[model samples]
Target: MSVTRPVAAQFEAYNKRDINAFIDCFSEDFRGYRMPAETPSTIGKSALREFYISNRFNNPELRAELISRTVLGNKVFDHELIHGISPTPLESIAVFEITDDFISTAWFYFP
Candidate 1:
């Protein structure tokens, strides 16, 4: 199925491991958060990039597949497979808040 440009671009950039392209999908002040253990949110695109880089290095086979998505207004919600890197079956929800320019502030949460 065909989705919005930004959504497709984000997925494409991520699958390719193109950091610049991935960041380009977000605004300059873009930020992200996750509820790993009830701690503070992960803020800023730079910090988020660092987190992803660390994960990628640690899990060389890391991969994510978009299982489903729903878009309403400027927000998009995605259900995805996160542990596919390990060929495992870990699932999570990704939330994307799209900006006027199609940039996004993303977040993830376990279900």
Candidate 2:
């Protein structure tokens, strides 16, 4: 599968509020963190699922708009605008690392 596929699948599943599909896009050892931080906020698929369920899936109106994307080998960088999470829309960038057809790690940045 293309490196960008997991990233796309993740967003698709997230928008659809399909937790199982979202979890499927990630590796069992998945790790996620904030940009420029070495420490991860989320580790493993189970932790990721919990984070998404509590923070994203609970928001029925949540939606993300892709502003731009760039792919370089196993990495996919996505610029996005997310709505309905907070009082106003949020602009962020997420970098996904794909390995063995699954997302191994991801880093999110908000400006």
**Best candidate according to lDDT:** 2
Off by over 4 Å in 2: none
Model 2 / residue 107 / CA error / Å? 0.6
Question: Which lDDT value does model 1 have at 70?
Answer: 93
- Report every candidate's CA lDDT: 0.71, 0.93
Every model's TM-score: 0.77, 0.96
Q: lDDT per residue, candidate 2, 7-106, as tens digits?
A: 8998999889999999999999999999788899999999999988999899988999999999988899999999998898999999999999999999
Q: Please give the TM-score that candidate 2 achieves against the real structure.
A: 0.96
| Error at 41, model 1, angstroms | 3.0
Quote the lDDT for 18 in model 2.
94
Q: What TM-score quantifies how close candidate 1 is to the native fold?
A: 0.77
CA lDDT, candidate 1, residue 84: 41
